[model samples]
Target: MSKFTSILARTFLQCRPMTNVSTKNMNMLSLMKSNSNPINRLAILSISDFNKRHKSSATSSLADKELATFLQDEIENETKSMETKATSPTFEGFNTELKDAKVILTKKSGKESFKVIFNVNNSLDNNSEEEYSEQKNVSDNKSNEDVELGSPISKPTYTIELEKNGQIMAFYCSFAEEGSYEDGNQSSPDSAGYSDLYRIDEISIYQNEYTDDSYSVTCDLLDEQMYEKLFNMLEDRGLGNEFASKLAEFSTAYEHKLYVNLLSKIKNFISS
Candidate 1:
């Protein structure tokens, strides 16, 4: 079998095939969705509202809209980074100068995982073909599985934010205790265990060009202690568990439009 196919078979790159629900199952889902609990009811309502908005405007689904917004933001950030390098005396080439990047944290069911965004330094790239090759090692730790994921992650613009970030040292996806974390592209997390520290260099603040929000945090020189600090920060704000749970559900569930709403809501909720 081809190396690429081998990785797909074992790695987290393969999304679980979504199965169609039978008519009886659909009825059960309807019944469960009608719970009087505020939280459960809101979820159903949000999903309905999300689909309705798309139909009303004859536009993309909420999930698509969110994905588009994320990619657009990534592009804008990457372009700004490139512009700085082009004007700099030490500027190298486009391939070396990373415009934008992202890393998704993976965990099993009921675990907390999230995604982080960062840019790159073109000067730092080793420029090896293997660095960006289709046969490159995937971030999975269960085994030495190979999958394709370099700059821009996937060919589709919408998949840009899904790219895992790296430079000299590189980044690996975090794993949960013992479960599948499809959202983070991490498989067999339980078997391999999780990494505490996610070392990154040359990180910087995300320039809020689209909005007037003050978010100046350069994770430059982030160390092991600092990684723990992030979780502590979330915990201090009392959003650590909630954040992880929402992310897990969003990653595995088939109807993602509702998760988009949840993500936006969480973004606003925590940012406030």
Candidate 2:
């Protein structure tokens, strides 16, 4: 799985198809991994069954409206839109508009399944500028700025498996390599220079269970090396205390603090 974290989604397909899922139980072994460069769209292949439940709200309760307003204001005017479909579409015959998010159906085995498209806002440029500015300022005190890392390709779409009861199953999160891209003259990172943003190297989610990208395994679930790496990343952000507090809530077996902290610098949308 460590090898998976460092490669592109294309690499995920290069190897021969496995008899069983490559990752313990992450069913999404076949994937385009969903690209973000051109535009965000999630298409599931090989699913044998699916059902869609669509609902759109033009009017809402005060609380719902408030939450919607809060999310909009929180994203620096980025609305983060999503749309849901009420029925299944044919194989390669989906007819919905290209949207930030949409609901669709697919089939697997003899049963149907539902998939929700979660559109992750692209923050590569935002993160790059912030990191570069901070590092450049620090270097100014010494002598000159020397930032090496270039912006990363952000995962724009997340196709999450949903249970009949509407519980989340698993989602595919593909990331791009650091320095794999540059400003104004971008090129594909198809060959090498790819990496995982959430640090999981494979398609499998931690424990082969229901957890969003915001959710992560408990300390015991991670090996010493991965644990230490995540801990260090948290330390750099002065959120070691928050991280410790999250782990302290022993009953909350799945902790999402580190991911939420890194992904949502302005808000904890996952928990919300």
Candidate 3:
């Protein structure tokens, strides 16, 4: 038998115990069982094709060993520096429930009940950090020490709802990165208010029952005073500047933990 055919047979035997082998590999192995010179028939195949066809066995290759080592180091490094937020344990009077990537916080005050929802998926991104850095230079030109806000945390979208009696009012809100003001004028009506804060996008009111037909009014249509009043209402409910900052921090920590968990899962899968 040729050296190439010998290698192919060894690979076939090595992966035969793996129940997850691809159909293509199984077909190739079956062809080898019937063919006299499987190597000669597959001679014209490029190196890339061979690598792709045998990717399952390649998990034990040297490249994967290096990758596994790198992931181990990365996971350790991230875990060492990880600092969870105070909200991770509990956020004030609101009870927390985590459903996959989404976080739902609920609380009741007097006769009104509130629900706040946000998702951690794609909430923390390096691209936004770069954009915020550029904007900071253009707007204030302050040193990192002067700013002290650290990397732009999460600019996650949040859905806040209030229920009173039999009516529900929902506010769709989003976090704005600090130092993201255009024209360096935060008070400008065109701006989304001062940076590093959450702003309301739209408001919808409906009966206790909600459906797809519910109508929402965009906050842009509201006058300046009306907008401020709406924002202040949220502030009174503990969703103000301090809460926004803490939310960003908590989101960053939560997202990073999720990422590390994913990395560990992938590492185990490849090693197996």
User: Which candidate number maximizes TM-score?
Assistant: 3
Error of 1 at 212 (Å): 17
lDDT of 2 by residue, 210-265 (tens): 54654633334446466456535434533233322221221111112222334454
- Deviation (Å) of 43 in candidate 3: 17
Assess each prediction's global lDDT (C-alpha) against the native.
0.37, 0.37, 0.75
**What is the per-residue lDDT of model 1 for residues 1-272, given as tens digits with 9 covering 90 to 100?**
99998988877634764367688987767767678577887788799999988697654445566665675565555455334322222111111222233222322122322233222212122333345543334544325655434431111111011112321111222223333233332221233665322121122323322134533333333554564565455445333444333323322221222223445665454334
Q: Please give the lDDT score at residue 100 for candidate 2.
A: 27
lDDT of 1: 0.37
lDDT of 3: 0.75
Alpha carbon lDDT at 245, candidate 2: 29
TM-score of each: 0.20, 0.22, 0.66
| Deviating ranges (above 4 Å) for candidate 1 | 1-203, 210-221, 254-272
User: By summed lDDT, which 10 consecutive residues of candidate 1 come out lowest?
Assistant: 153-162
lDDT of 3 at 127: 64
Residue-wise lDDT of candidate 3 within 178-270, one digit each (tens)?
445443222234455334366777899999866899999887778867877887798898877777777777787777778778889989987
Q: Quote the lDDT for 174 in model 2.
A: 29
lDDT of 1 at 130: 46
Q: Which stretches of candidate 3 lie over 4 Å from their true place?
A: 1-60, 83-89, 125-128, 131-152, 182-196
